[model samples]
Target: MKARRQRLILEIIRQQVIETQEELAEALRAAGFPVTQATVSRDIRELGLVKVPGEGNIFRYAAPGETPPLRRDERLKRLLRSSVQFMDFSENLVVVKTLPGEAQGVASAIDQASWPEVIGTVAGDDTILVIVKPKKLVTTVLQRLNELARG
Candidate 1:
């Protein structure tokens, strides 16, 4: 029952914006789950749901690790353009330098972009190490990053 409720919650959020626990509980009840606010809150925490910027000033719940491609691309471009100070690559690794305290945010944007060639990233303070798969693809990834940074 818990699993099914959680699944429904995920489905509900994916279908429409859910901005508050009360809204989620109401939706659950409408779906026949009959959940309490506490239950909804617990389910939110257990599901690791995050609140993301919605239309204008509103924010709505979204599943962790789930980002629409267009939004992700725009976010990555904005972060790269504003924060990235330098970028270079060697072999299968691309090094990105950002303003102080910006590396993790930049790395997260890169990760969210979900580029096929990128294996992963490690960030520290003002630097990010982006690991690419296939040595030949490193330059391609670097070029893409440069383009994003330029935007």
Candidate 2:
């Protein structure tokens, strides 16, 4: 039952811009799950749901690693433009320098972009280490990052 309800929650968020726990609980009830607020909260946490920017100033819940592709790209572009001070690469490793307290957010945006070339990223207070596979692709990744930073 829990699994089924959580699945429904994922589906609901995908289909609609759910903005609050109360809204989620209502949707669950509409779907016949009859959940309490606490249950809804726990399910959100267990599902690793995140709030991504929505239209205008609104934000809505999204499943882990599931920000829509266009929005994800826009977010990455925005982050790179605003927070990144410089980027450099060597071999298969790309280092991104961001303003203090911005590295983690910038890295998260990069990870969320889901670029095939990126293997993983590690972030500190003002730097991100982005690892790319197939050292030959480092240039391609760097080019893409530069474009995003410029935009």
Candidate 3:
């Protein structure tokens, strides 16, 4: 039951912008899942859904890792071009500097990218610490980021 409902949740979110738990629950009920708000919330957490800015001031849920690859790449490239001031690396880490208050947005974009080379990221007000998977891949990731920033 949980698996089927979770699958429906993914399907619904992919089909339209679901902005709230109530909205999701309603969608599930309409789909015949008849889920409660608490159950929907738990499913959201378990599915690792993250809220991304949607139209207007609203936010919509997204399964970060499941975003279409081409769209994800384009979004990441656009994000880097717009917000990344400069980037540098040492060993297995890459530090990205962004305009003030922009690091978090850029970092979130990177996280949503699900890049194999990236372990994770930590963002401050204007700085982001990116942990690369393999130490040798730091240069590769840096180069890719630079290319993305350039284009």
Candidate 4:
């Protein structure tokens, strides 16, 4: 029931600008989920939601923004930087090691960067295995990741 309500609330927020818990509560009720304000509050926290620009003093929630971390670009600047301990590539796979717990965020930043060489990335606690297209892209991928770490 909780997951159902939360999904409905998230869908509502994603589709429209939802302000206050009161508004969310009403939306939930409309969606046939009897939800309390406290439930909505907890859901917001659990979802890692943030309020972005909206109408008037009413704040709207959204999944955390993907606009790269502050003070740098998405790849080397945002995620790698000092946190990246090592990086290397073999064939079409690039391995990146970060200071534990940072790999996921760094990898997420890379995924959000929308690079052409990147087919996709698999991230662990402090490591990421980035898969590139056409094995030859290894050098280019490594160079791009290295540039990102520059920040």
C-alpha TM-scores of all predictions: 0.58, 0.58, 0.56, 0.51
Candidate 4 residue-wise lDDT, 8-122, digit = tens: 7778887877767788888888888887888888998888778765544455776787232222352347457768999988888999999988988887777776777788889
Q: Write the per-residue lDDT of candidate 3 for residues 1-151, one digit (tens) a residue.
A: 9999999888888888888999999988988887888899899999999887665557788887655444677778888998889899988999999999999999988888888889899999999999998898999989988998998
**lDDT per residue as tens, model 2, 70-139:** 5888889899999999999998999999999999999999998888889889999999999999899999
Model 3: residue 73 alpha-carbon error in angstroms:
1.4
lDDT of the structure predicted as candidate 4: 0.76
| RMSD after CA superposition, every candidate | 6.3, 6.9, 8.2, 9.1
Question: Going through the candidates in order, what is the number of backbone clashes in each?
Answer: 0, 0, 0, 4
lDDT of 3 at 90: 87
lDDT of 1 by residue, 58-93 (tens): 788999987745578888888999999999988799
Lowest lDDT sum, 10 consecutive residues, model 4, at 66-75
Predictions in order: lDDT: 0.91, 0.91, 0.88, 0.76
Give every collision pair in model 2.
Answer: none
Window of ten residues with lowest summed lDDT in model 3: 64-73
What is candidate 4's TM-score against the reference?
A: 0.51
Which candidate, 1 or 4, would have the higher TM-score against the true structure? 1
Better of 1 and 3 by lDDT: 1
